[model samples]
Target: MAATTAVQTKKKKDRTFVTTMKRLLKNKLAIFGLIIILLQVVMAIAAPVITIHSPFKQNLAQSELPLFSEGHFLGTDNFGRDLWSRIVYGARISLLVGITAVGLGLAGGVTLGLIAGYYRRLDGIIMRIVDLLFAFPGILLAMLIIAVLGTSLVNVAIAISIWSIPTCARIVRGSVLSVKKQEYVQAMKSLGASDFRILVKHILPNCSAPIIVFATMRMATAILSTASLSYLGLGAQPPTPEWGAMISQGQDFMWTSPHMTIVPGIAIMLIVFAFNVVGDGLRDALDPNMNLNQ
Candidate 1:
């Protein structure tokens, strides 16, 4: 009977996922966003193969070349580094930091949320910590962590992850609170199921909808925040092909070689847009009240 019930549950979950995906695909904005994200991912992965020239090698002679110049499709920065190569490589950095930071933040947030929501005795203490973190503005909080950890790409990711923790925990805690009140959760408690088993198997599965939405939206925030930090000279440093850093480098040549800054700025905007629209789509698709048929 237990095995049969488990099989039914698995089938139901699969059906739900398929339905959500079908709904998501029906959103035109989401399809466009996915295309943009896919293109960026392809460019990032094929950086070495697709790039016309080295992103870092400087050539004073070719410095500040106009866009569409031979051997330099997108032109060159002040240092004569290939704008196309730098932009392509920058995608790798942006995506890496965004994904890593969010992954870490989600892991920490989910654990704390599970403990706090499951154990009434721990909820107060855990929530207090989350509240304290939330007291600071997100960017300010990230800056403070970066100040202590010192500036570096790795440190930037860590700081952003720390900054992300409070919001993720709050979201997860709310979801958990609601989920744990469900009849199934109460039944699990009375059936001698371990706290770990109940939380991980039953409670977390039910809470996945909100968590998925949060993660998608948070990816947009994470990538944008990374660019902001790097632009402020606190994230990826000089010589790094990070889009924010590239923009910073090109600011001086904005008049003569505007593509240096404009190209990378556009890259950032497109990626952020991609994530935001996809997130919006996921939220709508995952909402139980949203009719999939419509």
Candidate 2:
């Protein structure tokens, strides 16, 4: 009977996962967002094969060339570096920062969240730490961390991850508190299972939906924040081909070559927008009230 019940529970979860995917696919904006994200990933991965020129090499003779003027399709930067190649390569850094930040935040936050939610004794301490982080705005916190750590692509990602941890922890803590009261969780508790086992095998799985949705949204914010930091000279320093660094470099030549700013700016906006839309879609998909038929 116990094995039968466990099998039934697994089947139910599988059905729920399937339903969520169906609803997500039905969302037109979400589908578009997924496409944009996939394309960016492809662009980042294929940067070497797709790029037309060396992102770092400069040609003084072709300096500040306008878009579509000649061999330089997106045109050259102020130092005569290829804009298209720079943009292609920049995708690698931007995507790397976003993914790494989110991964780090999720790892730390989920552990802290599970501890706080499962152990009443630790809740106050963990929550107090989270509250302290919440005292400052995320960007301000990120800036402070970056200042202390110094600037680079990896450091920028770490800073953003630090700021993002509290939000994920809070979200997961809430989900855990709510999930703990469910019948299934109570069933596990009534059994001879240990607290860790119940929390890991039972509670955490149920909380994954919210965690996933929040992570998606947070990824967009992470990308934007990292770009802002790079623009301000705190991330992926000179000649690195990062989007924000590229935009910063092109600001002076904006009037002479608007494509310089326009190209990378659009890339940043599109990727961020994609993540936001996908997050929204996931939120709806995960909602129990969502009517897939509707």
Candidate 3:
């Protein structure tokens, strides 16, 4: 009987996944966004093979070459580094930092949220701290963190992760508050399930839909924040092939070698757009009110 019930549960999950995907794919803009994201992933993974020139290597004689110039597909920067190579490699940093920061934020935020929602005594204390963090503007908070932590890519990631925690905590807390009141959770408690087991094995899983949607949308914000920090010289430093730093460097030569800034700018814009659209699609697709067959 238990085996049959387990099989039925698995099948239900499978069907839900299929339905979600079908709904998501029905959105043309989301499909376009997914393609862009996939391309960025491929470019990040195959950067070495995709670019002929070294992103860091310089040839002063070839500096500031225009677009589609000989041997330089996207042209050379002020330092004669390949623009295409730098953009391609920069994808790795953007994706890595965004994902790593979001994962860390989710870890910390979800813990606090679960504890706060499940244990009412801690809710007031936890939420006060979260509210305090939320009072500050995100970029200013991130800048303050970077100032205290000092500059570096890793520091930027840490700062962004910290900045992300309050919002994630609030989201998780709300979801947890709603899910905990459900009948299944009450049944689990009556069955003598441990608090940890009830939270992790049951409550958390039910709260995941919103978490997933938040994570997807947060990726865009994370990438944009990383770029902004880098542009301000608080993140990735000179010659690191970071997109924001590249744009910062290219700003001086805007009139002469605008391609340097434009290329990275376009890359950043497209990536953020892709994540945003995909996130929107996921939110809609995950809605129970959405007609699965439609």
Identify the leading candidate in terms of lDDT: 3
Model 3 C-alpha lDDT per residue in residues 1-294, reported as the tens digit of each score: 979978998998888889999899899999999999999999999998998988899999999999999899899998899898999999999999999999999998999899988999999999999999999999999999999999999999999899889999898999999999999889989989999999999899888988999899999999999999999999999889999999999999999889988999999999999999999999999987785445
Clashes of each: 0, 0, 0
TM-score of candidate 3 to 2 decimals: 0.97
In candidate 3, position 151 carries an lDDT of 96
Give a tens-digit lDDT track for model 1, residues 124-218. Answer: 99999999998999999999999999999899889988888888888888889899999988998899999999999988988888888888888
Candidates 2 and 3 compared: the better one by lDDT is 3
Summing lDDT over every window of 10 consecutive residues in candidate 3, give the lowest-scoring window: 285-294
Model 2 C-alpha lDDT per residue in residues 158-209, reported as the tens digit of each score: 9999998999999999999999989878887788789989988889988998
Candidate 2 residue-wise lDDT at 246: 83
Better of 2 and 3 by TM-score: 3
* Model 3 alpha-carbon miss at residue 35, Å: 0.7
Q: How many clashes (backbone atoms < 3 Å, residues ≥3 apart in a chain or on different chains) does model 3 have?
A: 0
List TM-score per model, in order: 0.97, 0.96, 0.97
